[model samples]
Target: MLLLLASLAFVQYVRTSSSDQNPYLMTDYSRLHPVKVERVLQGEAEAQLIGLVKDAKAKGLKLSIAGQRHSQGGHTYYKDAVVVDMTSYNQVLSVDPEAKRIVVQAGATWEDVQKAVNPYGLSVKTMQSLNVFTIGGSISINAHGRDIRNGSLIKSVESFRLLTAGGDIIQVSRTENAELFPLALGGYGLFGIILDVTLILTEDEVYRESTVLMNLEEYSDYFQNEVLPNPDIRLHIARISVAEDSYFKEAFSKNYTVDRSLKLSDHNKLKSNDNWVAPGKLLFNINRSTDWGKNAQWNLQKHFFVEQSDKIVSRNNAMRAASAFMEYSQPGANDLLQEYFIPLPQFDAFVQRLGAIVKEEDMNLLNITIRYVNKDDEAVLSYAKQDMLALVCLFHAPLSKAGQQRMKQGVERIINEVIASEGSYYLPYIAYPTLEQFRNVYPGYEYFFAKKKDYDPDELFMNYFYEQYGG
Candidate 1:
């Protein structure tokens, strides 16, 4: 009883400290870190980058870049930085259906790119599950999605145009200006302003949807024996229910495999089966506030969502944004995100430990979605150091000091577990992890910073995430 009281007190302390430190109420989704910017800029042409950089330099102001601002961390802005809002200038520059390549303005949303390329029967090679995210934002974070074969965005990118802090626009690819490629891909917008990117596209695949129920222990072997071996399966994801009846033991796997019976033309003729906007957005809002909401969501998924026996979809339709596109928030409460990549072999162990921390702590964990990530050494600060399971969690926390502290403690515990498993946590969400934890997860920080200096010697391009860890 005493410990519980102390825990509540600490949570209140954390919320108070966070509120005191964050002076402004304006922030991204998490509402955890609020920052004031000198000014914001928007433009429709590449020429705007030159003036934005020059003006910031002339005024001795720091620069921060923003897209749709979906990232939970203060990575979208820094205190007193000049924010460049990239959404209005969005445009799809080029689409080559035959060659499977696309050139898009940095701010173009995946939905914009999709609308342009869908007619040609082509699809993005890799991206986040959402279509509302900007192309540049996705590339900047090196986002990944259901396509296990495609890996991260770095794997699909052919090249990109970067506007340096000095206002020089340069093209970067694997062989041309190679070092800049990895740095900017996942640099969290600390290196340069992304102007445009050329990425690989794929022929839209017709897929048959399916799901399977599995216990937590059977996941690793099932993934190895059932998921990976099937070449026909193109998109895969998993969900483990956190309800009282299921907890960590009950789970379901979702997959989309090539539908051999359907021709590309045949798919084009089919009507859109679902928008996924209404149900997806509805459930997302419910999860933001109550325990019953979370359980209700899983109940629906278990009973209704997992019943997919032979639903078919085009690759683009399958890739459409669902839950991630929702823009909902509850006052005095924040939706927080944490992601950890546990090495594949340590999957079961990681889950068991995770269960204890979450349950014992009684964290307001609202959602847990898992994905497979192949080994990726492409990004300098790569989270996938080894083949791993990317477990993404969404938690709802009250604005009270105690709630915030509880969240902080929960995040730290998860981070420690990930580190002990020889894995790494993602940097795009939450500011709870320590600078030391950042260094520990991404040992290449010094090297990445050194390379960053070559392009941004003035340290002009920055966000709260970089300002915290780049030191």
Candidate 2:
């Protein structure tokens, strides 16, 4: 099986003033496009970068920013732009255990935050499955994890410092500069550079992991009836079987509930990611090509996660995002990701139609993970306008010109289906939808872009995403 491990080590780049780097070759996690830029800052101090921002504003040069570059598409890059690599500036500012809050430089990753707050017996309210993503990137995407009650990163944010296009550092929170809060929170770095972030933390309690099997039809009801009613459960997620017989017809749910009977130990009990690297990579590589391999992976996971899902672990340990399958680049293939946010009532219809599309398109469908999101009314270009299911689809596609063209056509059908169900597909993914389709799904985009003019009159913070759909 092919292994593409996600790198946590900082990238080393030579900051040379050479013309050869012009399409500024940089790629995000997708490995789909290694783009070109006018210049990329590899070893510049924060002050120097801010000066660069001012210099860009003065010379009318396009400027962009990236932290870890984990975003899928050009969410981190723009053609002919000066991209600021922000990871070097990352540092924990302070931690207030009594208030259950911590402040850190935006470029700090969740892994950094966990280490800081864990000593206080606190945990992050929510974060992506893995700890490799930078906090700034997470806030820009408004990322959410298994904690359904808290909703998204926005729910945990207290405030942050944003550097606007004019190179002015401004404080934005629910109060005082209130309008800027939502814009910066999920603004996709279009508004400004997040200098720092203050996030609310939670107790690192012991949670017992358990799994339940149910047909697709019973998911929503079962969630509302059994999952939501319990206060002990903190994390909930389910997998849709990709096997030929079950094929979205069946699902296995995993719930992590706080165990009062146990207390979290004074240690991180997670096995070294190396422990699961081989099996995890093999399972996904097989799931990419064979139904038998896919079924085998499911059965194997079921035996460990379902048959005796009663294992107890610390909240901090339960949330590590180190699975090898969800790692970095594939040499000859691309791990394409497309997420759809369907209205709660439309979940059943949406999934059924989606399954049909997969069958009809013969998509190399590997896995579908379900998550609950509450209405994110604050973000200007909010995906979760109401409670909905976020379906994260990860699949393998050949890295060829034809494969990209095929992916474009296939994702179009997916966008239409989501829109037809009164749902909107998430941005920060494949730039397949036209501006018309984008506006149709996100009706408030016009107002959002309009507001951008007030803050960024010259339109300095631009990316491939806005270039494709921000009409």
Candidate 3:
């Protein structure tokens, strides 16, 4: 019944933290902004930073709130605005093992929550690709990792504490503020700033996972139907490996029972090779491949391991068996990536068209990744509504001339096709597409704006996306 610490102490901290660092250096992660603000709040009262809220509204200044700065899109960063740094507010408010719920402050990172719930033999239903991200940030963006069984992380949120534009503090849930709850779920922080979130946790169990190398033609059906149906299976990632005339696919899954029919010997041979390295590291070598055709090869990595429900564990190691990692793309790479989540029926055709394009253009298809997601609650901009989703991430290492050309043309053509298919691009990885293309992807941007207007009429909370698309 106890709530996290009250908000009074947090504002004072925010007031002081603002002075510790130069406001010029403060950023929301993606879009850097030069602004003046009181301070970044920490602790329970962060949710109720009435003074900061009042100040921003009083000056009719736009305010931007940030947790971990993990979002790839321009959703978090703002310029010449009051930025609420929420990192100091990290804390586990409470946990109810019997009810399978855990309350956490908005600033709390996934790492913090995972540790707190470990003792309860519980874990979140889903998490982002990385654990360093903050809980509230995940909910705002509606993030998801490789898990196809669950939708995005928003589905796990049972309720949240939010501060509205009017400076009103309220707790939101499915049963309470029902309409606004789902609206703000994937609403991209348009409704208000998330102060805290309570999520439903799953009982821990042994995760039998494995990685497999297959071709596009080989596992398209399995990805759409089999893996997405089981709620227990975690982390389904498919990456297209561009090697010479042959193209191979790398697929990873967690807590899965190995299929006896699969060629165990072949799967073992592939994993043993150095081909299975971490994704970030693979970025450096992705351009080394000689041939760039649309053919398919799949490298399968599966893990069949079990651990007690209550042990603090590592999700990064569990998410991917490889050790290669990469940073966010720098500004202005000639190449671009276009990802579309079309209806399952269009999936096969989409891939076929992509293959044809790769062949016709002689494009160096870097890596094509396909991810599956179950249907989610209604949100006008929700990308997971499709019965199944195939996220095709084509890599183009602008570091190389050929890679840059291939990526540029490939992204442009792919975006055109996606628009034609009535499919949308994921904001996180979007590097191309015109404003018109973006507007088509999010026709509900106006709806989001209306809601924001009602909550923070003064536009105290603002970001690059807000200025560009918030209307």
Best by TM-score: 2
* Ordering by TM-score: 2, 1, 3
Better of 1 and 2 by lDDT: 1
In model 2, which regions exceed 4 Å deviation? Answer: 1-24, 266-274
lDDT of 3 by residue, 408-429 (tens): 5666676677766666667655
lDDT of 1 at 281: 54
Question: Which window of ten consecutive residues has the lowest lDDT sum in model 3?
Answer: 299-308
Is candidate 2 or 3 superior in TM-score?
Answer: 2
**Where does the lowest 10-residue lDDT sum fall in candidate 1?**
12-21
- In order, the Cα lDDT scores of the candidates are 0.81, 0.80, 0.59
State the lDDT of candidate 2 residue by residue for 391-461, as single tens digits: 98986777678887777778889899888999888787778776778899888888778878788889899
Q: What overall lDDT, based on C-alpha atoms, would model 3 receive against the true structure?
A: 0.59
lDDT ranking from best candidate downward = 1, 2, 3
